[model samples]
Target: MFAMLVRLYLTVAGLLLCSMLLVQQAFPYLFPDQYSQSARHEFSGELALLREHLRGVGIGELPERIAALNRSNPDRYSVLSPAMALRLPARVLAELAASGTASDHVSTEHHHVYVRLDHGDVVQISYDESDFPIRYIAYATVFAMVLVGLMIWLQPHWRDLERLRDAAARFGDGDLNARARLPGGSSIRQLCVYFNNMADQIGCLIQSQRDMVNAASHELRTPITRLEFGLANLGDTLDDRVARARVHALRCDVEELDLLVGELLTLGMLERSGPMPALERIDLSAFLRASTGVSAEELRIRSTHIEWELAPALKEVVVEPRSLGRAFSNLMRNALRYADGTIRVGAEAVEHGWQLVVEDDGVGIPPEDRLRVFEPFYRLDRSRDRATGGFGLGLSIVRQVIDRHGGEIHIESSPLGGARFVMRIPWHQPGEWRGRSRAPREEPAADAGHFEHSFHLQ
Candidate 1:
């Protein structure tokens, strides 16, 4: 809007300046007839009186003497011959040369100039000087007028801009109730109306989100409390083998419920957690070796082959230590549950970062389920309900953690005829992993059918 006002001012100024210059140039050309007429009248009256004066002086040739007077007074009179004044009717010349005068002033084409002879009309001459004053006056007037017009045009617009800026600042500062009011009869009143409507929509959306969080929390808290209380009461009554078995099952159910509730809460919190998890440089070799050792006992029960080919240069990777550890654990759990012949875990330093691969020889994930398997509470096999030892959040958590670390995950059918999960996490700095690779030997596969049946129960 301010730009438009500037354009308007420039356009007006340009047109006004051009108009003024044109008038200054054209004024003299447009008034030739008027100048001629006024010049003729003044010259005729002066020349006639001069001729009469010559007659009184006893000059026989009055016309010739008047011509001589005009020649002698050329500087003081029009360049036309004085005798040309007689070309008017004899009566008009007589009246002009009469002993008495009508008025002392005569109007020229441009202005008024008064003339009078000292005595007996010996000489009479005058010229108007007020016809054209300085051209700066016109220019200055135009400039001032344009300045005033621009101020008038921009005053309301500036106020509107100020109001919009103030409202935006307040809104950004979280003042949802703040509003920008337009002038009652302003040109941009509609814009202000739309802005207010948009603010209203945003406010509604925020309120709805808060309400959803509150309702979900309330619904989930009740079941979690009941499960915790039931588990506590069961522990008090357990003594015999039968009671102990029932209590153990109850404990397992309670643990599952607690994990589910914790995951849900984590999802909610992570969505609003503005900052990424804290990052630090980590030695990938040491980290992976430690993770493998911690889960070695569990993996031994599967009797599945496991191999590692960690790159010598895949040492330190920049990641949030806790989140990265959790992600790795989730991946390991998934692989251990489904892998049959062998699971290969390795890292290779690539151009951008350290690339980690976890491949196995179990039934590969179907093409249709690859993407859906990453959604919360989503499972590939509909017949295998999540209640049967699956919560469907492992891959979802993997994706969340990878995203927070600015990494990417890739899925493909591995050469080993099983699903493969690849992760690319950036190195903290270049050339930081100049060391040796560490890996463990492979083991045999577990009894295939035995593993399949016992896996879900575990």
Candidate 2:
């Protein structure tokens, strides 16, 4: 707010200074004769009075009379000798010689007049220049008043803008209920109304999408369960081997469809706008071990070696256990499919949070496709076949889970020559942790290295 005020003040100040300069430059052109006419009108009376005083006064007594006039008047009075009068500008001297009276302005504040007496003395009348500082002080007071008025005008507008900015930020961060509430007389009231309308439309659209996905997933479950049961019964009745194999294939297809529906349901749940899931404080090391072990056992990938690199400093983290566990399981299963012989699942302490990494020793994802891999139904060309690829909702669900935990996940090139999925989650969830007891640590095997512990599958 201070920065914004400073910028506004500087802009206003610059414009005012520029306007003063432009007016100064254009004033003469705009009113060329006004200055001269006003100056003449002003000093005409003074010149007449001086002339009356000097009339019939002898040249020798002119200096005494001028001194008396100077002591009584605010303006200076002087008598110029013929030689001194010769030093005047030719224009002024000529004008005085022709009209017996002349006026000249040295600057905007300094004015001078000359009159020719009958005794050949030039009586000079001029304004004093000592009031220059007073003029500057007046200008400064005016400018200060203008500054105060500007500040008064900007205060309410700045306050309104800040409220709008905060509402927009909260809305962007997924608070669909956030709205900018401003006074009716506020200058930006229309803008606030527009923003609120936009937010409403967007919130309704997202809610609609979630509701549709939920409805579809629920609708699919019944048919999928019936088909699975029918396929199982039909397979049992089949006698021929080829027919049984075909029935098994159909069952597999139905199972895949059911899995897809389940993923869609989970995605919809994660995307719902509401309070977060209940959080539990769990030991990072135990969670990693359990998640990786479960995924390996489920996939039955015994040939691949799993290594754990748990940082000692990382003790416990607050998270929704079920959702985070599912995310880690998905990452492990993904690594299992692409790993050549080894997979690394590791956790380490980092600034503000902890880092979880799952990497394999297979071909790394291309840089261009790393981010897109987290989009639902997105897969690389090489993983297009059913044997290697999933329905492609796994990584999308992983991202949603991380987002729910107020964390971020990204893919990087692994040191082991494959795609590395890194999840960074904060150490604590707001208003969630209640100081639970830490899980008992598992002792490392004697052969485990100092940097990491290993769980050999085969």
Candidate 3:
């Protein structure tokens, strides 16, 4: 801080001195009369006051008395024109010649005072430049004060800049969360906010990548271990039936491994940074029924029921159909695992876009676990047992796909006494959508009721 102040002081002082020197060098020729006339006006009052004081002394023997005064004070006082050979400017000579009064005053280029006396001679008073270095000192002092004030104003800016530099340095050194905190009212607050935002996004991205790598490594172990155990058993087994069962178990393990890898790849694609996928305008009702129809049949074998009926007005929605279908499939499969007898699914237009709801009438998630249930490899207590639950990658896939669609998913207590997962997804093209009628969709053939349309709207 001291070094900065010193530098500013020197720089500002140098420029001020140079500028003053330039004005002094050019003033006589460029603005000759302006400065000279003002200077004369200023000292004119002093000259008149002195003349008044000397009025009592009388001017009868002015020339003789001036010579005596000059002899007495060689430096401070001088008598001019009549006796001393002091050179005067032509303008001053003309003014003196034309004046009706005796005490006419004029200013000189060398910065002297001239006063014409009644005795037809002029009195000159020349000031030595050395005696008043205080004037130049006054200018420097004012410049110093101004420079100090400027430094005070700039101190906060410099401090903020230094803080930002340190934050960037720490980030470069692998501190992912390093961020600059500046005062709210500071001049560079907007810049600091943008920097902090960028840092946060970078940190989130890296953390997500880390989570993916760790979870993939951990989850791949079960199937690989099973395959190894199956290989160990294959050569030693004697019974044909036992061998067939072992082969079936091996095939299932291989299929599970393939499914896990496929899901992982899909999740990675969703999380990766890229341009948005091209959208297709599709009938939302037909798409929903077709996608859920397969899931409903699969669940029927396990005696699981899914109640899905798309609203008629929700027909045309712009979206990446394949990816969105995968997300919906995830929700369907997830609901089936926990649903006791019935699963409810539907879509409705909301203020911004569409809200797809999946609810089950089974065990609802605990309040504490609701937030983290969407994370990869996050399994509920029931789900930890493979007999009842999956590998825990299903909801994670749903979340990634939903996030890629620029939407959010939230969980709440269902009206059906189970967990309700609301995937609030916005339309791909916001400009094309407005309010549309919520007419009913074509009814599916009822086989003593497949599933219920569970929306409680009267």
Candidate 4:
């Protein structure tokens, strides 16, 4: 960490130092007015002054004055450039020859400038070094400190981001409990909250799935064991009454096993994937007739007052028939199980779609238990009440189907004081595929994975 930060700081600081040097060198040229109010030929100013000083001091030889100045600074020199010295303004040069010392800036600020000696040779002398190495050192120090401040601000954010990434990686690798642990006031606290929420939800779902699998296994073992024991001991109970009873019990066990397998496959299908969707324009009137017709015998047996309140405007809809049919069947069966003598099935148009309400005039679901009844294998009574209880996957399948159709199914208290299953499904106007027969979907592909409707024993 130290090495990496150091390297990064050095790289940034180096670049900034270089930029500072470039800007400083370019500033005087880019904006000349800002650097000076008027153009001053500094070299010429000192040169004119040198001649005046030399003549007034009665200096005959320039070497003597140069040697004397050299003793004080060791950087003074006089070169005989008589050819270049002649082009000066003679008046200014003559006037300056009467002076002693030049301006302080001309004497000290400039590193090198030429001066005309009374003998006409130009003297070249340096006052100060213009490299400004100290200024560059100061720039580098400030730049490094800025980089340090930036790193200090970024370090915590990097640590938080890295920790979040690691936690997500571990979660993806099946460590469901993995979570990003951040301290209070951390900058990424919101992101970590979302991640942890997602993790918790996924963990709960997986755990629920595991619980369902274990429950299914245990439930399945009972019927199989009963069948095995019944069959194995059948010969010993050779009496006619005993043999017949054993055979009946074995048959019941087989049916129970079949029912359990079917329900499991149904639930598995809903969980694993989406339904194969090929939409067609469905005549709601006819579709409802057919679906309810299949349950006519049970409805009649119970003498249930069946009422249909389908709106005339809700005549046709685009839908995947097989999936929709299953949803209707599950709701109808569920309503019939606990409904009183009257069952009301209604359909009406809503804002963006249609609403289907399947309610029965029976004991409504308890307020607190309505939501959980939709969960797989959850029983409201939690007793040995086989007549009213179901495999608990019915509403789950209903919800899954409605979800697949881009709709919502809500349980409500009906006008008739019973549990109402309300489904609001959208219906877009059919395209060219309206009323066209879709290519037949191959079965068994889904049959093995998919589960069936909720099963009620009574």
Give the C-alpha miss distance for residue 209 in model 2, angstroms: 2.0
Off by over 4 Å in 1: 1-226, 229-233, 292-294, 383-388, 428-458
Q: On residues 391-458, what C-alpha lDDT tens digit does candidate 2 reach at each position?
A: 78888889878766666677778889998887766667545534322222234334322312121100
Better model by lDDT: candidate 1 vs candidate 3? 3
Ranking by TM-score: 2, 3, 1, 4
- Residue 319 in candidate 3, Cα distance off native in Å: 0.4
Q: What tens digits encode model 4's per-residue C-alpha lDDT throughout 250-347?
A: 66656666566666766666554323456789899789767753366877887786788888987888877776787788888887887888888888
TM-score winner, 2 or 3:
2
> What digit string (tens of lDDT, one per residue) describes model 1 on residues 1-458?
66777788888888987886666456534764454346556666664564455445432343365467668645343222345443534433453466322122233223321222323332334444444566457768868888788989788988897897788766653456658898888787888888889888886776578458646866877887887788778778877788877877777777777777666655555444245545667888788766642365766777886788787866677767776777777777777777885888878865445577887888989866776777878866566433335577777777766655545676778888898887665454333232111111122134111111111101
The CA-based lDDT of model 1 is what? 0.61
Provide the global lDDT of candidate 4 against the true structure.
0.65
Using lDDT as the measure, the top candidate is: 2
lDDT of 3 at 212: 74
* Candidate 2 residue runs with Cα over 4 Å from true position: 22-32, 40-49, 67-75, 80-102, 115-122, 128-131, 293-302, 429-458
TM-score of candidate 4 against the unseen true structure: 0.47
> How much lDDT does candidate 3 score?
0.67
Please identify which of the two predictions, 1 or 3, would achieve the higher TM-score against the true structure: 3
- Model 4 bad stretches (over 4 Å): 1-246, 429-458
Model 4 per-residue lDDT at 298: 79
Give the least accurate 10-residue stretch of model 4, judged by summed lDDT: 449-458
